[model samples]
Every structure is written in C-alpha cells, then in structure tokens.
Target: MTQPTIVFSPLQAGVPAAGGALEVLVRVQAPDRPTDLATAHLPKRLALVVDRSGSMNGQPLQEALRCVTHIASHLTSQDALALVVYDDKVDTLLPLQPMRSTDAVAKAVAGVEAGGMTNLHGGWLAGAQQLEGGTEQTVSRVILLSDGQANHGETDLSAIEAQCREWLGRGVSTTTVGLGRGFNEDLMIGMARAGGGQNYYGETAADLYDSFDEELALLQAMYLRQVGLKLLPAAGVIVEMISPAQQLADGSWRMTDLAWGAEAWVAVRLHLSPGMAGQTRDLLAASVSGTALDGTQLQAHAPVLQLPVLDAAAMQALPRNETAYTRLEELAFAKASEHLRQLAKEGDRQATQQALDVLEKRFGHHPWLSAKIKQLRQLADEDSEMMAKEVRYSMMRMSRRLVSKEEMAYEGDETHVSESVMPSFMRKKVSEGKGKKREV
Candidate 1:
C-alpha cells in the first residue's frame, strides 16, 4: 500500500528563475476515512492523573469522577489504564492493568476524596511512569485533569514541560484538561505542546463528559507515529521552518506524530540569492519518515520544488495558487492572534486593536476565524489570567483537532463562568439568562 503523502504547497507554485525568497507549506496526511480500531490492533496505554486538591472537594471532584466513568466505558481489554490522584501527595489508585469493568473503575474513582495542596508535577510524573517504555505500536497518553494551582512539589512550568518532552521521545504523550478557572492554563498548554498531546478546557460537568468522549475518539483513531521530515536544499539555498519542528545538528528537522483524521502541516520559508534568468534549478528535496499502524516503517519524498528563472514580468504573470496563499494567511492569523493576546494583557489597547484590524482585513471572510475574533473581543476586558487562558485555547484548538465538546457546546448553551473572577458585565449576563429558553 502507498504510504501517506507529504505535499508541498508553495506560496507561488511556480517560482521565478531569478529567485529571491519562497514560502512553502508542507502537509502530511493519510487517506482520509473513518478508522476502524478493532482491526487496527493498536493497544492503548492510558494514565488518568486527577487533581484532588481541597478546592475540588465538592462539584468539581464529583464531576471529575463521573468523567472517569465515562472514559472507562469506552476502554477495552486491549487497553491498559492507570489512575493517579494527587493532593499534597501522589497516590496511584489503580496500577497499570487491562481494562476490566466500568463499574469497578468508577467505584474506585468515587472513593477518592479531595484534600491538601496540589502536587501537580508529582501526579503527572507518576502517571507517566505507568506508561513508560511503551512501544510504537501502543498509543500511550497521560491525561491530566487539574482544577487548582500547583502548590507543592516541582511547580515550575518549564521544568515540567521539559520532563514531558523527554518522555515524548519514548513514545508517551501527555494531554491536559483544565477544569474550572483555578488551574494555571499556561502550564497546562505548555505541557501539552511539549509532550505532543492535545489540551482541553472544561467549564462544567457536561463539558467534562463531552471532553472525555472527544478524547476517546482521537485515541481510537490514532495511526501515525514518530513522524519526521528531512529536507535537502539544493546548493546555495537556505531553508527555515516556523512550525513545531526540531532542527538537528546536520540541518534536518524532526516532527512528531501525525494522525489519520487530523493532518499535520509545517510552514517553511526558503531563502534564495539572485540567480541567472532563463534557467531552471532544483530548490529543495524533501522526504518524510514514520512508522505505520501495522509496524511497517514508511517513507515518502515529496516532489522536488524547482525554481524557474524568469524575468520579473514573466514571474508576475505566472498564476499563483489561491489555496496555497490562503494557507499562508491562516498561519499569519494564528500568529497575530497570539500577539494580540499579549498586547491585550499588557493593556496596549491601540496595538491590540491594530492586530485585530489586521486579522479582520486578512481573514474576516473565514467564518471560523471571524467567530474566533468575536470571542477574542469579549475577552478584551478580562484580567490577564482569563485573557491568557482564552487566547491560548482559542489559537491552539483552531490548528489542531476539535477541542473537547465542552468548549464548542451548542450555541446558547450555558457557559460556566467563574463568579469570583468574571467581570461584572459577564456575571450579570449569566445571571440574567439563567432560566431562559433559547435555541442552541
């Protein structure tokens, strides 16, 4: 069978022979279809690290237990699950074991009581240990749910992210779910990216349940593994990529997993010095390598990107691929969104508005992005904490697979806003609409 294709969509599909600089977007995608997990034989190694800090003593803890039950129902005997709970101390409530019964697992979760400070790092690391030394064929993930700030044991965000990155190379990824408003969103998002896993936001009990279901679907559909890209630029050409790639000492780049349903892409810009006109030369040669679901090693080289040296007028006449240009604009919007958030947090209203204007001018036609911009506007008056969380989640979810159901719940659905921290306008709006019937 043919391996997945790595397609290069150049900013200008046909480059001029008198080359200057070229931008290309690299996309890696499998044949798109519903993946059948039963036949795939991809065993799962999952660790659920729950934060039982004192702040979660009531509804948050109860809802989290229910979420565990939801996750357990979807697991099969071929999957191994470990449950780790943390307060001031870490406890492995369920050692790594094949899925048994949902009732049994739920019962164990129900018995967990919330207490003490949060040892966030300790809890997550314990869960990671359960999934250590996993094979490429096994999908290993550490799912961490926290509703409180870390107060005990290795609370530094960078330190935890570094540890997660180290473990990801060993075939383990970490997914973080931030419940309610107390947990530090930056730490959760940073850790997820470092570990090459997904992140989620849960505003309520219902959102938590939906998040679990969404995550389970992605887990079942996992296919690609240890995916990396190698680029060999032709002599006199320099290449630089802006996506999540690690540059090796030899100038190659390494990218992580690419799933079937969710495609992976990298944005790269090539620098080329002026060359003679009326000549054709190879710009760059690229190849991608990864392991397939059937334990087969896979590799495929993209068609070489070539430069056609032509006069300025001829180069201008060459047709530009509209789709490729749009992809570049999308990337620009993603970057600007991040910067916009920072400016807003710093109270630079003028710069923030300018960033928003740039986004509107470039991407206003995009429905998803337009809606996202609207949401960002609502967050403008929020404190730095809320703005950071909302912005990070907004930008991250746009580029990746769907965030858990809680975030995109039906329109008019009740949003669980924190009463203590929410601005008066939002709190009043939520209170006023508490008992209204509106179409979702």
Candidate 2:
C-alpha cells in the first residue's frame, strides 16, 4: 500500500489554449486510521480548563464537571491529564499527572463548585502552565469550557489571541468551548484559530456532551494536526488562496489539519499564461510539511499538476469539476455568513437583506445552499446574532476539518472516528455516537 501523502487536484480538466487563469483545489489525504500499530500516535496531554464564574452556577457548572469527567475517563495510561477552574481567582482541581487512574481525579472533580467572576485568561494560562513540561513527543491541548465573557482580567481579544499563538509555538494548543449565549463567540473562535485548535460551542449545558465527544473523536482520528504547504507556481502565475491560512516565516501557508480517512482542502485561483494546445505542462509544484500520526516529522512533495492547453472556446466548454465547485461554494457560504453577521451587527437590515439576495443569486443552483440562504434570511429577520454565532461556529469547523455533507447537515457526527488508539475506558464515548464494539 502507498503511504498516505499530499495530492493536488485541479478543477479544470486542462488549461485553455489561450489560458489566462484557472482554479484548483489542493487535497491532503490520510490513507487509514491508525490501526494495530502501537506507536502510531503521540502521547496526548490534555488540560481541562473550566470557567466557574457566576454564570455557570447551576446546570452549566454541573455539566461542565461532567464534560471534564467524560474527557478524563478515556485517556490511555501513556497520556496525561490536568484540571483547572477559575472565576476571579484560579484553582487547580487536579495537578498534571499521567493517566494511571481516574480515582484521584474523580475525587478532585466531586467537590468543585461555581465561584465569582470570569477570569477567562487566568484559567487558560493556568491550564497551559500545567502542561508546561510538554515536549515534541506529546500532543498537549487545553480544552477550556467557559460560559461568560472575560470580565475579570486581560479582556483584550487581540492580546489573548496573541498569547494563544505564542503557546502554540511552545507545543501547547487551546481548544475552547463556549456554553450558552453569554460567552463571547468572537473571543472563543478567535482564540482557537490562533492557538491552532478547533473551536466548538453549544447553546445549552447539555450540548457540552456532544462537543466533548466530537472533540475526543477527532483527537483519536487526528493524523496531522498542523500542515503547511509551499506552492511553487509556474513562472508568472499569480495565485490567490481562498482558505483562511496563516503564512509562516518560511513562506509556506499553514492549512487545516488532516484527519484519518478524510481529506483536507484549500481552493485557489491561479492566473496563467497561454500555452500550446498539443503539449501538457506542469503548472504547479507543491511540497508539504507536518508531523505524522506517530509524531515523526514529515516532508514530501505532491505530484505536479500537468495541464493540457486548449483554445478559449474549448476551455470554456469544459465541464466544471463537481468536487471543486462544491468546495468553492462551501467557502463562499462561510464567507457570506460572516458578512451577513457583520452587517446585522451594524444594524443595517437592508444591507443584510441585500447580502442574502446576492448570496441566493450566486448559489441558487445548489438546493442545500438555497436552504442555508433561507435559514440565514430567517435568522437575519429574527435573531441575527444567534444565526451569526451558529454559522460562525460551523465556519470554524469547516476551516479546521474536512466536513462532509452528512456532517454538515447533522452538525456533530463522529461515526467515522476511530477508537483504535484510545484506551479501554475512554473508548466508550467513541461508541456512544455510533455504537460499535471495539477491541478494548
């Protein structure tokens, strides 16, 4: 079997005879989930950071404790766990330790209760501190559960996001969960983006379970958490990437993570020059860099895209790549949702309607997207803010993972997530989503 590697697929069948521009969608695929290989995955180190502020006094706090417990119950002996909760002051419910047993951790979680105000920053910082000894061998993540905005200390979104990015460089990534409508969606979403982790949210306390389960499933299926691509375009070709990517100091663009048995993609528009119709030429060369499933460094080159030149009319007559079309549309939908939310925030109802109308006209061909159009319109007419949060969360997920149409419709489906790497105790949640007997 071939080792899973990065691959590039273009939307166009071939370059036009008078080629001026074209589009391509790059995909990175992992062949299979880590199976019987014992060393297939890195040791996971997770910190459960919960906000025990006044807002989480009742069900939120209770469910949050349950969420922490849900995450803790599944770790393998090689993995590690820590617990931190904060309001005006921070508290470490459980010090960082290897997952030898959940007994002591259970006792620590039992006496926890809600406290005062939201010192969101302090809690997250404490969580990172707990994982301070993390090295390249361990995948350290701080899963924060919060129910309110940062009102106590260091409330600036920019500064918080910068700190999260700094921690990412130190082998610590932050995954934030927002419970209820009270927490700042912008901050939660932004922090996750900078910290190199996926952002998740729920409308009620009960929804926290799904968030925790889905996150754990993804972690279990995680192949490459951080991937960067350097595009070596043909001379004179100008490229514009549609995906939200962070440019590295080395000039490569950081892209979304690739999960086991799934594909991660980025859409790009390229400006090309005319070529002869009889000959095919390599238009783009790409090299990928990231950590593999076993924590081994990965560096490889994808096959070059060779396109056949064609005449203007012939090229225009070619059929669109259905896959690329759907991906481009998905990217457009996410962007429209963002724009609609911003307009709604400005109190410009007319502009919001105009945006929706334009979106409908643009994506009116796809029935599913048409449905989204209607949903966005309804939300704009009624609760635009709610629509904004919900759609933005979906956008965050789309940007981080390769979302299938089924996952898009259902929102939190983890049936395909593998439990091959999870410990016997922790593998239970893996079956809850889609009951499957595992070899514990």
Candidate 3:
C-alpha cells in the first residue's frame, strides 16, 4: 500500500478580480498506515510535571492525582518516568527512574500534594533535568500540566521559553496540558512550540485523561525531530511566506505547530516571471527532510514546478489581458496571505472571528464547512473558549473538518451541558432556518 501524502496549503485571501502576479498549486502525499504513520516503535523517556497549586485543592487536584497515578501504572519496565510537582518551588517527586517496579511508581505518584503558588518555570526546569540524563534515548518527552498562571519562581516568559529551546535542541519534545482557565494558554502554547510539541487545554479531569492518552501516543510514535523544509527556487523565482510559521531559521525552517501524534502540512507560494512569446519557463523547486528524534532519516522531494506557456500574440497581450488563470491565481494568493496573517496573530480573538466570517461568506454554501461553522458558532455561543479555540485550530491545522464528534462533545461538555442534547427550541430554530432557505 502506498503511504498517504498530506499537503498543507497556505491560507489565501483578497485576491484582486484581475491581473494578479502569483499562483499556487498544492500536492499532498498523506502517509500510509494511519495507525502508526508518525509513531513507530522507539525507546521512550517521559517526565510528568504537575501543578499542585493551592487553587487545585479540590476536584482539580484529585483528578490530577488520579491522572498521574494512572499514567505511571501504565509505564513498562523498559520505560523511564520522572515526576516533578511544583507550587512555589519545584519538587522532584521522582528522579529519572526506570519503571522497573510498580511499587516505586506508586510511591512517587502517592507523594503528590497540592500547595503553594504556581511556579511553572521551576517545574519545567526540573522536568528538563530528568530527561537531560536520558540524552542517549531515542524518544524523550515531557508532559507539563498546570492549573494556573505563573505566580512564583521565575515568572519571565522569555526565560521559560529559553529553557524550552535548550531541551528541544537536545531532541526532547514537550506537550503541555492546561487544567482549567486559570492557566495561561498562551504561555503553555508557546512552551510547546518552542519545544516542538503540541498543546491542550483541559477543562475537567476527564479531559486531562484524554490529553494524557494523546501524549502517550505521541511519545510512542514520534520518529522524527527538527523536521524542516528548505525551498530552493529556480533562478529568478521568488518564494514567499510558509504558512503556520513556527520559525524561519537562518539556514533552515522549523515548525512545532503540528498537533501531537498527528501530521502537519505547510503551504508555500512562489512567483514566476512573465512568459516570453512562444516560450515556457520553470518556476520553483523545494527539498523537504527531517531528522527523527531517534536519529532516523525521513525525506521527500518536490521538483514539481508550474510553468506558463504563451504564444507570441498571447505574450504581447499578457500585460493588458485579463485572463481566467490570472484571476484565479490572484484569488488564491490573497486567500493564502490572509490565512497566514490570522494564524500569526496567535490568540487574538477578534482577528480569528474576522477571518472565520470571511471564510464563511466565501465558502458558506459548501455543506460540510457550513455545518462545521454552525457547530463552531454554537460552541462559541456557549462561551466555551477552549472548544472555540480548538475549532479555529482544527480549521487551520487540518484545513478540513477532521475534528471528531467526540472531541466536540468533550469541548462542549466543559460547561457540564451535553452539546449532543441541544435544547428543543434551538434545534427547532435550525430546522426552521433550513426549511426557509430551501423554500427560497
């Protein structure tokens, strides 16, 4: 069976009605064997950093404890585990200990207690240390759980980011789970990106379990690290921004924007020179490759280029002609640019809303997308910030309706109201709207 190839497209917007200078064509090769496409067998090292702050004194704390215990119990003798609990100061509940015995694991998990301020930095630093010792391991990971913003220890976000970078440089990946709204999603998100991992917001204890499952899956599957794209345009071809920009290194490109245990796609744009009379020209070329965390090699080639051929008369008229190809190309570029701008805003609600509105207006008639927009709007109405954020993220991440019903329900139920059981009145209203639109 051929491996499925996934293609990421740049978000486009505001193409001129005519005479645009850019065009984009995307080809995706989604990996085959979805079950383990990204996760092949590898040695695993994990550190679970939990926030047992004073605010997590009740249900949250209990749930967090259960989560840690459950996760520890699942580790095998070959797997290594570390526990870091923090409040005002970071505490190393368990050093980088091999999970060779269940008793040791139980003892480490049982020792967790809730108290003090939220010292995220201290917790992260300690967790980093645990994994640092396992540098020889192929797949190393960190799971950071926090219930509130940083209030103690080093509160500077930049410093925390620097630490995350250091760990990533050593082939360590991190996934962050935010418990409740008290935690800073931006901070967690940033930390995850810096470490080339994913981020999740857990509104309840059950949500935390789901997050843990995902983290486990990622740790088990990650086969690549520092995956990058280097675009080398044919002479005279100009390339623009790469969508979902995590970083544009001086010598390479790096992105940690992909979801955990999931593949991510990026879009790139190229500009071509105007065709000469009765002539054709090549436009661009790209090479993509990445190093696995375990030092495995994975790569793909993209020599496919778009060429424009024009006759003598057509070439003479190119400067003044308004052609279908030109119009479509302009629209595509505009759409891609706007999409990148919105994504880069990073947590700017207003900008996201505006972008959504534009997408709806343009593609609202598409049945699937329309339904998703409606469902997303419902989540937004319920003031489920996390769900809303997921909706936005999903749209950008997959560029399709890849989000599952269970995930939606998980997000909606954060308010304790089952989205599946919508009120009769609201259902009736939707039905009526559909009826009216059909009649029209």
Candidate 4:
C-alpha cells in the first residue's frame, strides 16, 4: 500500500503559555506514485440518472443525450453502466452491463424523449438501486443529472439527502450535475455533500462534457473513497472543523475522497484552556480513515502534536508556519466570496464593494490571493448568479480538498484549466484550448 501522509501543523510553531484558541492546519495527502495507478484503478460501475422533463424538451435534452453517449463511448470493457431517465415517472432505460459495446445503450438513449414533471428523487433512487451490493474492488457511483426542480415525487430535500448518505454507507456514492441554472443547486449540492461525492454544474453540451471528463479523471486516479477525518483535542481543547464537512452517523467529519497523489485536508480551529507556564504539551490527535480501492479499510493516525508552552517574549520570537497561515487565508477568502455572493444577489452593490475591499486589504498582499479577490470583484459586477453558483460549489470543494491557487481560479473560470490547473494524469484527457469551447 502507498500509505498516505497526514500531518498536523499549528499556525504558530509553539503554543503560548496562556492558551485560548489555537488553529491547526491538517493535511492528508495521497501519495503520487506511477506504479500505484495500475493497482488503484480497478473496474468501475456507474449509473446515469438523467432528468428528461418537459423543461428539457429541446437543447437541454439534446445536450444530455450527447453527454450520455459521449460517456458510454469512452467506457472500457471492464466497466459497467446503467441508465435511468425520469420525468413524472421513472424508467430504467438500460440495466447494468459491461461496456464491450455501446450499441445497446445507444439504442436505449435514442428511445429517450422529454417527458412530464421532474421526479428527481425517484430517478436518483432508481439509479442507486441498480448498484446494490457493490464490492470493494469496483467503484460504484450514480451521476444524477437534472435541469429543474423536483416537484412530482419525494421532493423532501432532507429525506433525499439522507438517502444519499445511506447509499454512501452501502458502498455506492452519488455525484450530481445540475444541467442549467434552473436546477436546484442546493438539492444537488446537498446530496453530493452527504453522499460523499462531487457536485458540478454546466450550461452547455461542451461544459457538461468537461465536467464529466474531470470526474472520470478523478475516479480513474482515486486511491480511496468515503474518506473521513477526526480530531481528538487534548484536555481543555475544543476543536471545530473550519472547512466544510458532513457529520457522519459515527460523528466524524466526512470529506471528499482521495485521488492518488492528490490531497484532502481540513482546517480546524482549536480552543484551548490556559496551560501552566514553562511546560510542553500535546495539543491534539487526528486520524484519516477510508475504504481502499479493493474494499480494504485503511487509516493513518498523525503523531502526537507537541508544542512547548512559552512566555510572552519567547512566544513572540517563535517562527510561524507561513504556508499554514495561507490555508487560513484561503478559508477566509472562500467565506468572503460566499458573503459577496449573497450581497450581490440582494443588489447591494455598495456592501459588495465594501466586502471586496475588506478581502483585498487582508488577502491582497499575496499575488495569488489578490488575483482571486479581483476576479470575484469583477464577477460580482458582471454576473452575480453565475458567481453565486461558483462560490457555493467552490466552498463545497474547498472544504474537502487541498486545492492550489490554480485550481481555485479554474473553478471560477474553466478557460484556463487545460493549461493551468489539471495534473499530469488529466492533461491528455483535456487537450489544449479545449476550455475556449466551454461557455463557463
């Protein structure tokens, strides 16, 4: 096994004698090994639950079909795909079958036409049912695609999200793709968060294809799924997950899964009671747990984090982890962008600029963070709704993944992903200048 590295870094090198609140940046980075690629990527099983409602009567339906076909055409013989379409009613267009040929699925896709209302929950549930009893070696997921709200059946948002979480425990994950602006972003994103999967949105056929491509690349390079993180604070220390997290039944914070050579992290804010002067102390304990590709359970526990208790002068002389502070800034920037989105939606331009100014003042010193602030500033003025979706979706992603500045920028503007963001494994899948074709 290519053991993952989990490190706990304090914002300051050492704790002050009079401790109150301490923030720790926790990172779980998946090892990137060329040899692990062959061992990590086993066969995959996918269920595509597509919304074929009345609202999708034209271009929407066409693009969806095109995307389904595109995905089917790319699957290897070792993979399996199941198709389900829902409107007012639900139908399984195709049962789970190996991908030796796309002929059968193609015919099934051709027969699909836009129907009545959007039974979003029913469609997703049907897709999950198809992947029941998935073993450890096979990666199973449901790609729930929708263009509108669910009004016909099981429209309860909480119920739907809970089911997604339940299915995740059964070895099946869920990824939601909102076809257009009309789809319920909250519902789609909520299900993904709870189900321990990804949430994405696209406006066109090319955009959909791009989203699908990213997902496939991530899956093909995955080492573990349903990754969870837990922090054990020492006596008198209270810990909170600053990053976005879903509370599991067992109380651990569930994060996005791990891709080989990639990183999943959580920013934790620790509150500590006062410690005795001139003493060394252990701050907290942490563990990263997940299911490996072949169904084996794995975990990595971080070493006991120890810091020396120092007096005022000594604490002032301590060196800070500059890199760790940047993570806190990243978290702040994400939250600020979300605030800016809400202000923009309310048509409060003055407050929006004020918030942007605050972000610029705090994060503008760094060249990279400054760029993001300006990017959000311009986006708020030009398109608030699009900016809203980007920030919300980004917050969900950032809370789980340890992304770089380039990746963050790509979330707001995909025109640069092919050139700036993707890893080596994804370079071939997304060609140069492909982002230009995308409307995002």
Highest lDDT scorer: 4
Best TM-score goes to which candidate?
A: 4
Global fold similarity of model 1 (TM-score): 0.83
Q: Write the per-residue lDDT of candidate 4 for residues 1-440, one digit (tens) a residue.
A: 76777878789877777876777888787876566365554688999999999999988988888778878877899899999999999999998888888898888988889989999999999999999987888889999989999999899999998899899989899999888667888899889988877877777667767667667767777888888887788887888888777667777888778877677777888887778777888889888888888778888898878888888788889787775777677677777677777886777877888988987888787555665567667767876666566666655544455443223422233334442345432222111112223323
**TM-score leaderboard ranking:** 4, 2, 1, 3
Q: Estimate each model's TM-score.
A: 0.83, 0.84, 0.70, 0.89
Q: lDDT per residue, candidate 2, 288-317, as tens digits?
A: 777765567777788778877887787788
For model 4 the local lDDT of residue 54 reads 97
Model 1 off-target regions past 4 Å? Answer: 32-41, 248-251, 343-358, 381-387, 399-440
Q: Rank the candidates by lDDT, best first.
A: 4, 2, 1, 3
Taking all chains together, the TM-score of candidate 2 against the true structure is 0.84
Candidate 4's C-alpha runs over 4 A off are 34-41, 347-354, 366-369, 402-440
Per-residue lDDT value at 429 in model 2 = 21
- Writing each residue's lDDT as its tens digit, candidate 1 over 282-311 gives 888888887776668899888887757777
lDDT of 3 at 5: 33
Name the better of 3 and 4 by lDDT: 4
Model 3 shows how many backbone clashes?
Answer: 19
